[model samples]
Target: MVKVTYEIVPHDGGWAYKLGDVYSETFASHDEALEAVRIVVQEQQVGDEPVEISYQDESGKWREEYSDGGDRPEVEIIDRFRPGEASV
Candidate 1:
């Protein structure tokens, strides 16, 4: 399984969570951002029905495949403002 981490940090004069190079929308406060992360994590845990998925490959060719609902990456949230930690 793939491991995904949501890192909470200050961004755009507010707070937001980042996954790899992507950042979520900014929240007014750290607590608000943390709450948003909690909601996202909870939603991610809910499995969906398997269905045919389509995507474009690097060569610009369209590909379609059946996806398994049970297949999902493990995820966690990391708070950057915790005590004894200077950064995430």
Candidate 2:
């Protein structure tokens, strides 16, 4: 299973959660941002219906396959600025 991590950081003079280079909308406080992350993580745990999916293969050809709903990625949230560390 793929592992995903949401990193909390300061952005746009406010707090945000980042996954790779993508950042979520800014929240007024760290608590607000953390709450948003919690909501997202909860949503991610919900399984979707198994469905046929299409994707481009390495050869640039379109391919279709059945995706299992149970194959969900493991996710976690990480605080970039731990307690006692200077606030970003």
- The best candidate in terms of TM-score: 2
RMSD of each candidate relative to the true structure:
3.1, 3.9
Question: Residue 21 lDDT in model 2?
Answer: 100
lDDT of each: 0.85, 0.86
* Candidate 2 root-mean-square deviation in Å: 3.9
In angstroms, give how far residue 19 of model 2 lies from its true place: 0.6
> Tens digit of lDDT per residue, candidate 1, span 19-66?
998999999999898889888877887888999999999999999999
Best by lDDT: 2
The TM-score values for the models, in the order shown, are 0.81, 0.86
Looking at candidate 2, what is the lDDT of residue 18?
91
In model 1, the clashing pairs are: none
Cα-lDDT of candidate 2: 0.86
Q: Lowest summed lDDT over 10 consecutive residues: which window, candidate 2? A: 79-88
Residue 21 C-alpha lDDT in model 1: 86
